[model samples]
Target: MWRCALPPLHRYPTVDELAARAAALAVRSSGDVRLRRVGVSRAGTPLWLLSVGRGARQALVVAGPHANEPVGGATVLRLAERVLADPRLTAGADATWNLLLCLDPDGLRRNEGWLNGPYTLGRYFRHFFRPGFLEQPEWLPDGADGAALPETRALLRLQDELKPFFQCSLHGVDVGGAFVELTRDLPGLCRRVAHAAARLGIPLELGPYDTLYWPRLGPAVYRIPPPCPRDLAAAITEAAVESTWYHPQRHGTVTAVVEAPMWGVTAVADGSPPADRDGALRTVSHALRRDARVLERVLARVRPHLDGVPDAARLLAPVDDYLLVCPGLADAWDPDTADPLRPLPPLSTAHLTALRIAGGRIAVRTAGLLHQLVTRAGRDPAGALPELDALIDGWCAGYRDDCGARWIPVARQAEYQARVVLAAFHLAGARSGESDWGSQPVVPMHRE
Candidate 1:
């Protein structure tokens, strides 16, 4: 009864359309799946949380804190539809399902252009919009008061109100294949999750993004590295992070971060040494460094163009500051630091790495936003805006030339993430029952 198939995702729905569709679905459904507006976005858009089934236990699944990551939105919709039609699909679930699709509507609205059609790299970057990391809902402040988005506050309240048994924060990437994050090492469950990802046809990002500095649990899944002690405060709302923010001592909660790429790179899926030796790892590291430089240069050029052009400074400055933090994302892959039997670092990949693709995506957005800034300046034939545009144009061209990625179907990625959610939920059921999924053949998950 576990349905992993997703609707066609060649195109995406606008925020308004997606919200309306969700609302309409709720209205038409009678018994189990009930939807309510949990909170409102700063832009006044309604944020709905759909509840399915009646049970004491609960599972919280959130998607799309970042507007550009629309794959999560697709995943949640399919899941809700599937669970509503057949509540038994949740078979042994002792919990209720609280599914939230697209928590950040204002940011998603800013990305409207690339949402509907043409899920291509160029179009996506051109219309991309993600807020600074500190401003994101998942990382909202817990201690010394700091600025927080309304969407963040809403989720915090929800997390506090209904501390669930499992949390699956669905996310997506653009460059590499797929990667996962779990709160701790549950090898059997990890394998189950990995197998579900394999069915989606994308390889695991052996060299994952963001884990370069953190400890990893397996080839593709990494442990949720701890933040400073301040993050554990009682008010930190759902653990201050989507993966580890549930309860005291994790209190019977399990979480996973499922990130899939838009493009399929052989290196991302492969675990063996490249024919060119460590060339692939180097290629990935070099890309990150190059991306950092591109972002720095783009930020410099766009700074001067922002005066009196209707929210230009407010829109661009924080993003500019955030880009500056990209350079230090990873340390150079030192073979000395690699595991003794492993040819590369524990998390290193052969061909395309997640950080490489992630860096390229970020650089493209930085350049694209700079171009937007220039365009907003009207006809500046003789000003710095035109010169800046010209520079960013070259970066954009170079980015496309470098990636040369074939955009995979979004539905495939969504299906994979959704299936992982299902896998995690099943794992939760097993956990509460105090058992494992028994033994199964380990799928040779990576090609090398």
Candidate 2:
């Protein structure tokens, strides 16, 4: 096990703080570390990229692709610091590290209200901000109708320049066990990464909601599925594209998405087949439908007041997408309508169901942002705010009672994520047949 203590973070750092730290690290490093301005965000915040180590191969680590998921930002800083302190980490992988500190600074700044601390579910939702699907930099499709955001373009430019052998996008869950999504199935890699997280006392997410359809490599480790025809058609209709889908084909980069959780519950680790699979599926489907209805009602009430509200379209984008597609999502979970030839869907566990229910937080976040927009526009939300607040409150309470969700400390979360990254880095190096590290096993690193 590659053992090292991750620096304890009392709270999530702000965008400025992250930038300053990256600058400081580069300045203090001995020529091996370099920092550069990659691109400017839509809001004019300069996107910074830190290049650390001088191995033969190239690897890219991107953090904070989604504004609400800040854990990755912390992971990036920690990884950069660790590799700088012990170059052997990257040397073993035979790779130079290209770390993008934060991909969505504008969206991250909107989420700063809850970044500092009190990592409670309620507070996170209160200050949460996630851009709409098309608004996300990473998921932007190539040759889409509209121009790619500056952040996406910056990543694309880096991809062209480096054609990295390995790319890891750090992502996090608000409430669930830890999991990972890999672009390729490198033998023993998933198990090694999962064991690293498990050693840190982080429960493995057996069936994460987002990767439910993806093929499982091991416990909590899934293979990122290709963009389905349905998804591609939707992207075409929306004039959007997913970069992850095309990046592998274009660059032959083995992409790995490491997902840690701000909060975790034991139920998510349960992999026992549900005794009543159809009933469990129906229950989850019904809950999703119910949440969608609540969001639809709130959107309908607030739609009239949205005129002239700055960013109203962006704020409502997710809500609209959720409302429009939620019914289909719910139906997909319905066994009656499920494809006969498709493998059995992930069995619903209490934590998996709760994670699905917590999807309502997106609606809650939308309502909160809409309230601000409406208030700024000098118009009332017509009771939408209270309804959404009630919805969030109910979800939080359920998270506590039903799912047993507990806040995972910021440092521990970062440690688990860093371990996964290191393991993947070594594994990717070995898989590339460019290094001898594969001959050495990834010994399990336990928390001391």
Candidate 3:
């Protein structure tokens, strides 16, 4: 494995800080780096496209596609600095690097409150702001031409312009373990990334969670599943099609999404079969159902008060989506209907439980957003604030007591993310027979 030294990071940087760093790097590169304003966000924030190096093949790295996930922004900045410092990293990959930093500046600004953090669950949820699927640039339906967000259009324009051979979208979870999703199952990629994460004291997620239905290539690595017929139909009609799906179909781009965790827990790392499979499944299912109900009750009460409030629909869209889809997810976990031939790993319980808590956090966050909207509109929050606030506090305390979650340092998370991306970049080059991948060192930023 190639080792790179990344500068230790104490906290996550804000969107403006990341933008400034990118600009500074471009200025310091003496014409080796170029920065351009690609497009403007929904709220008119400038979308930046930072280009570095030159090669036969092109690679695109996108950070902060999701507002709640900011680790990627740091990864992109650090990786850009490292590449500029050591041109051989991209030179050996035989690829020019194009990095898009902070795709959702509007949503990211709402999340800045806890970015440079105490890294606690409570603070994160309190300041969290994840837009609904309809608002997320990365998952807009493929045919929604007139409806596409400006950020989405910018990314689409980049893909068409660069026609990148390799893409890495940096993403992370608030808790659980680290995993990677690939558009193509490149041999040994998973092993290398999982090993690197393990070396960094990061747990490899072997559980059924976000990529539950995806095809697993190895521990913690999954191939992005193709859109099902139903999903394709929905996309043609109204639903969103994820970027992971859109990239490969349009450009045959070998995309890798690296997911790290802010809080690491061992439960997601354990691969042993669950002792009480049915019990674990039922427990998680019950939690999801309860969370959905709680959110529903709160939303029903606040819906009338939010009828004409500005930004109310956008803020409550996630809650509405959750209430609509969460019940089906709960029902799908029916232990009685589970495939007996294929059992879940022990991590399933912990991973599913973490997801449950995440659901609760979303509910609380939605209620809080609603409360703000109602208050601003000169209407009462209908006594929902106290209940939601109590839930947040209770879940935070319960999570601490149950999981013994460890705060994965910001630097460590970035380092692991950098390793995965660099390794994948190397693999992409090797597969293309463009360069001597064996001789290329995986470079990372060192502390000044």
Q: Residues 13-121, candidate 2: write the lDDT tens digits.
A: 7899889888877776757779999899999999999998788789899999989899888888888867766645667667799999999999999888789877788
Give one digit per residue, the lDDT tens place, for model 3 in 1-448: 2223444456887879888888877777777679999999988999998888877788899899889999988888777866776666656566689999888999899888789888888788766778887787887554436447888888877888888878989888876788888878878798888778768998888753676655789888888766543453234222225553355457667888899898887877776555776686687678767876777887788788777888777777766666666655566565765455654434455456555555555555665565555655675657766776787777676667786667888888888898888888877767767767546454444422
lDDT rank, highest first? 2, 3, 1
Model 1 CA RMSD to the hidden true structure, in angstroms: 5.9
Q: For residues 39-93, could you state the per-residue lDDT of candidate 1 as single tens digits?
A: 8888798888877778677778888876778788777777776666554444334
- Please give the RMSD to the true structure for each candidate, in Å: 5.9, 3.5, 3.9
Give each model a TM-score: 0.81, 0.90, 0.89
Residue pairs whose backbone atoms clash in candidate 2: 140-241, 141-241
Q: What's the candidate order when arranged by decreasing TM-score?
A: 2, 3, 1
Off by more than 4 A, model 1: 1-9, 89-92, 141-147, 229-251, 274-298, 330-347, 381-404, 434-448
Q: State model 2's lDDT.
A: 0.75
Q: List the residue pairs that clash in candidate 3.
A: none
